[model samples]
Target chain A: MLELEIAHNWPGFQLQLHLTIGAELIVLFGRSGAGKSLTLRAVAGLFHPASGRIILNGRVLLDTRSGINVPPQARRVGYVPQGYALFPHLTVFENVAYGLRSSSKEVHHRVMEWLDRVGLADLAGRRPHQLSGGQQQRVALARALAIQPDVLLLDEPLSALDAPTRSELQALIRTLQRQLNIPVLFVTHQLAEAVLLADRIAVLEGGRLLQVGLPKDVLHRPARPEVAHLVGVRNLLRGQVRGISPEGLRVWIGEREIRAHWDPAAPPPPAGADLLVCIRAERIALVRPDRLPPPERENLMEGEIIRESDYGLSQVLLFRVYGPRLTPERDYDLEIEIPPYVYERLGLDRIRRWTIAIRPESVHGIPCG
Target chain B: MDWFPLLLSAQVATLATAINLLLGIAVGWLLARRSFPIRDLVGALVTIPLVLPPTVLGYYLLVALGRTSPIGQALEALGVPLVFTWRGAVVAAAVSSLPLMIQSCRAAFEGVDPELEQVARTLGRSEWEVFWTITLPLAWRGILAGMILSFARALGDFGATLMVAGNIPGRTQTLAIAVYDAVQANDPTRAGILVALLSIFGILTLVAAQQLGRRLAA
Candidate 1:
């Protein structure tokens, strides 16, 4: 287990992080320069936090208050920095064996085992410069793992590889993480990569951790608009609470009233309370214009496709409502996604006018306060 | 040609080159790894013997070891003489060539990546082991080149040797002095032979230095 509560002052930013990660793949997901990498560095003992404590496996790695700090080498944390940072002068085998100089013959056997595990045993004699970028990355991973660290930290390990190589390496990393059962803190900006590799994801912005939970929960129920945006939620509408019902709460967005599956744990939004309703682009269903309105239900709008972009597997469509923009007090834009097959079935490219239906459970509401 | 003086000159030049190569490596390593007040000033001082007229260095050595100075008196009390001796000539050559070795070794050491050293330390190698196994091997080429350059410089030292260790045939005379003596005696034939031998030695050292540099770059 790794528990950290750190507060540090950067040049123009302040970082305050509180997190507990068990022996699982916990991805620190955020946009560029959002302090995810800095957090990893701090945990690895490469960067000293100004205050607070870090404990790994019940051992105090850092405690600014108690004046205890472990140097990076002694912390026994394996850090695979971005771009691998492999020693260009050393051959792959030598690189992997570097951290094993003090060990006996058994350690040499372990090094070879790791090299074979990474599928680079045959390339051990080749220098780093002779290997492809992906191969170099594996060599770096093997070298880090040869030390058998307590925690493994990877900073955008896949960002340097090509797409196909990245996918393969990602699968390899997932397998390794499971086999080792070590607390791995993987940092990356790619949301899809985080969803695929992480058992739980922590979303960060502006040096703050906005939310940490299972990947599905963080994606389906972001705590803030910024978190929603960072996780690729596309439709955020400003609205006001109209009324509360036994089933759920009703919010008024523009001229349309919408129902949201109310989260009981959240503070009740007083009537007329301003709020933001978020919905994923893929959740907004497009219906034929001739379909009659469902009885007594809310959350329906007629809009025209103003722009569209093809993304191979899916097409993103931006819509402008026929009526005036959601009031000057509550401006909002709607977006929808349709898979390529769905687009062909709906003939969405030929029709500009359509009705978009947002299901209540699919729409999440957060009080603007 | 006086065969005795010629042989003595060759022996002194060879010994001086060998001594300078070892001293250069030691001093270069120190300069590369340690920092002290006036380090840059000391670095400049090392190279002063290279640029200053050889006669000036020779004159300074003469005063410092002329039996009147404390160092010279102490040596004399031990029944060892530096003045007008073959050892004095070797000392002068080593001093003249010291800068060349330091410069080469410094450049070589500077080329090694600091990250490699850090990695070694983290991998359980002590600082000394890292220097020997990783740092030295990587910079060996540059060190070799520097040693050779210093050797070549020491082989050609003339003015300093002449001033401190006078022109004692078969004892203090080096190749350069032998050639100069031959010229003063108006024997162009002997002078020509000694000058040719000096030229050959200079050319061989230059070629060796260039080849080693190219091999390292490759």
Candidate 2:
């Protein structure tokens, strides 16, 4: 386990983060300038905070109160900085062997073993520039792990790779983490990457962690409205609870009473409690008149296509309900995203009036307080 | 024509360049990586030798290390006095050309990405190890350029060398002083030869420095 409690102050920004990571991967997810990189640097001992205590396994890496600040060289942590600052002058084999301390034969064996593990054994003789971006990233990972560090910290390591290579490396990382069984903190701003790789997601914005939970929970059930927006929950409507039953809870969104899914495992909120209904745009499905209407429990509403746009792979359609508005002040109620193929198959361009349905499971409710 | 002065100038420039490499790298790295109360002041002092007249620089060196000065007296007791000797010529040349070496070294060290050093440190290498393994290799081209420039400048140094080493016939007379001596004795043939040699050597070093600088930027 790795524990971090850091408070750093800058001229215009301040970062105060406290998190404990176990043997699983805990992704530090945030936007730019959200202090994700700084947090990783602090863990790596590259950035010193004003006050903090860092412990990995059973060792105290930093304790400001006791003034026991171990330097990065002795911290026993693997750090792969963004852009993989590999030794440009050294070959791949030498880069991996840099931190190993043993006899010459042992060093060579260890370096080659790591290179083989990363699938870069063939390129060991080549310099960093001779290899592609993905290959360099692998070399960097190998070099960091070669030290047998107690914890691993990666800062946007795969952001520069292509899609196929990224997914390949993601699998490689997962395998490595499981094999090592060490605390791994992966930093990224991409939600898809975070959801795919993280055992738990930690959301941060403006140098503050808004929420931390499982990917599914943070996605479908964000703790705060800001986190909902960050996780791509485009339709957040203000609502108040009207009633509760064994089936589900009823909430008033605008002038309409909509039934949203509340976690049955937890104590349900009382009636008249304010809530912010989180509805993912992709979850809102466009109902085709040619097919049978969806059951009433899955919210069925009549809305018109207020606007539509094409973004090559996907299309965004701004929808406005006809009867009562979900957001009365805005011109549009919900923004829906569908693939171009679906848009064409549905003949949505020619048709403006459409019925939309949202699953109860998709309509998540968070108490607004 | 005798070649004693030519051989002496080459020996002095080579020795001075070797000495400048160490001092230059130390001061240059310090200036590039460290900040202190008198950082700018120290930087200005390092550069002052370049902007000052060589004769004025030589006068200061003479006062600071001559037989009358404390350092010179200490060296005398140690039996290595520098007054009016070939070794004094080396000192004069080294001092005169140190600025070029330091400027090159400072720029080289600055050009190196600090991220590389930070990464190396995390990999269990000490600060000293990181400097030798990472920083030195990356900044070598710049330092080499500086050394070549320093050699050229030291080889051709006249005003400072003449002041401190005093242009003795066979001991302290370097190529530049030889050229002056030949001209004073109305021997244009010898003066022309030495002058041509110095000019060609200077041009070659400048060209080499320019090439290295371009490659460093690339």
Candidate 3:
């Protein structure tokens, strides 16, 4: 287990992060300058926190109260910085052997074993510049693991690779994490990458952790509207709670009513209490106008296509509601995502008027207060 | 040409180059990696010998290391002497070439990415291990070029060595001093040979420095 409670003041920013990571892959997901890298630096003992304690496997690596701050070299924690940062002048074998210089002959064998594990054994004699980016990353990983550190910190290790290589290395990292059974703190801003690799994702913005949970929990149930936005929730509508039923709660958004999944853990809101209902774009379904009359649930709405775009694999459709009272005057805008296959089958490109339905379970409501 | 002065000059230049290379690496690494009070002042001081007239530098060294000065007295107490000696000539050449070594070395060390050092540190390497296994190896080409430049500079040193060590035959005289003495004595043929050799040495050192730099960059 790795625990860090640090509060440091930078030039124009303050970092107060408290987090505990177990033996699973915990990804620190954030945009650029969100302090994810800084947090990793603090754990590596490269950046000293003005006040905090860092504990790794019960060893206090840093504690201002006790005046015990281990140097980066003595921290026993391996850090693979962004770009892999392999020693450019050293060959792969020497780089891997670097950490094992102090170890016994048995440990030297282990270093070679790790190089083989990372699939860079054949390239061990080559310098870092001679190896591809992916190969360099593997060498870096081998070197870091040679010391048998308790915690492995990776800062955007795959960010520099191409898409195919990134995926390959991501799989390798997952396999290595399971094989090592050591707690790994992976940092990345790519939401898809975080979702694919993280056992638990910590969403950070402006130096604060907005939420931390399993990927499904965090994606399906964000703690805040900002988190929902950051997580790529395409539709977030401000509304007022009308009433609660045995099924779920009803919210009045603009002149329309919507039903959202209710969390029993949340405090009950009054009838007029404002709330935010969030639903991911991919969770929304688009129906032909001739399918049938709208459902009785508050989620069904009639809108006209305002904008549409297609990526190679997916399509995004932006819609604006039509009518005298429910015109585009309202602040809420709805976006829907469709797979390429669905886009072709529905003939969505040939029509402009459609009914959008958000499943009740897909809509998550958080009290604005 | 008589070979005595030529051989002595080569010996002094080689010794001075070797000493300058060692000291240059040490001082350059320190200046690049460390910060302290008057660091800039000390850096400027290291280059002062390069800018000062060689005669002025030689005169100061003579006064500082004369038999009466504290350093000279201490050396004398240990039964060692540096006054008007070949060693004194070497000392003057090394001082004159110090800036060349330091400048090249500082640029080389600064070109190394600190991130690489950080990676080494995280890999359980000690500070010294990182320097030797990573920093020094990476900067080896630059350091070599710096050594060659300093050696070439030392070979061409004249006024400083002439003042401190005095132009003694087969002893303290170097290539530059030999050429100066040949010119003074109206021995134009010997002087031309010595000057031609000095020019060839300088050009070869420069070409070697360029090639080493290119190899390292590649």
TM-score of each: 0.81, 0.95, 0.94
The residue-level lDDT of candidate 1 at A65 comes to 86
Candidate 1 collision pairs: none
For model 2, give the RMSD to the true fold: 2.0
Sort by lDDT, top down from the best: 2, 3, 1
**After superposing candidate 1, which stretches have Cα over 4 Å from the reference?**
A5-16, A31-41, A44-52, A87-90, A101-104, A203-211, A217-220, A223-229, A233-262, A269-278, A289-298, A327-332, A361-369, B1-103, B157-218
CA shift of A359, model 3, Å: 1.6
Identify the leading candidate in terms of lDDT: 2
Model 2 ranges with Cα > 4 A deviation = A243-245, A264-274, A288-296, A367-369
lDDT of 3 by residue, A1-369 (tens): 999999988788888889999999999998999899999999998889899999999999999998999999888888999988887767788788877755467766786798899997777689888988999889888888888899999999999899998899999999989989999999999999999999999998888898999999789899898789878887787788999886688878778777888877677788999888887889988776666534755467777677878887899888776542222455437778889999889877787778777778898887888
Question: TM-score of predicted model 1?
Answer: 0.81
**In terms of TM-score, which candidate is stronger, 1 or 3?**
3
Model 2 C-alpha lDDT per residue in residues B1-218, reported as the tens digit of each score = 89999999999999999999999999999999998999899889988889899999999989988988999999889998887999999999999999999999999999998999998999999999999999999999999999999999999999999989998999999999999999999999999999999999999999999999998888
* Candidate 2 TM-score over all chains jointly: 0.95
Winning candidate number (TM-score): 2
Q: Kindly give the stretch of ten consecutive residues in candidate 3 chain A with the minimal lDDT sum.
A: A323-332
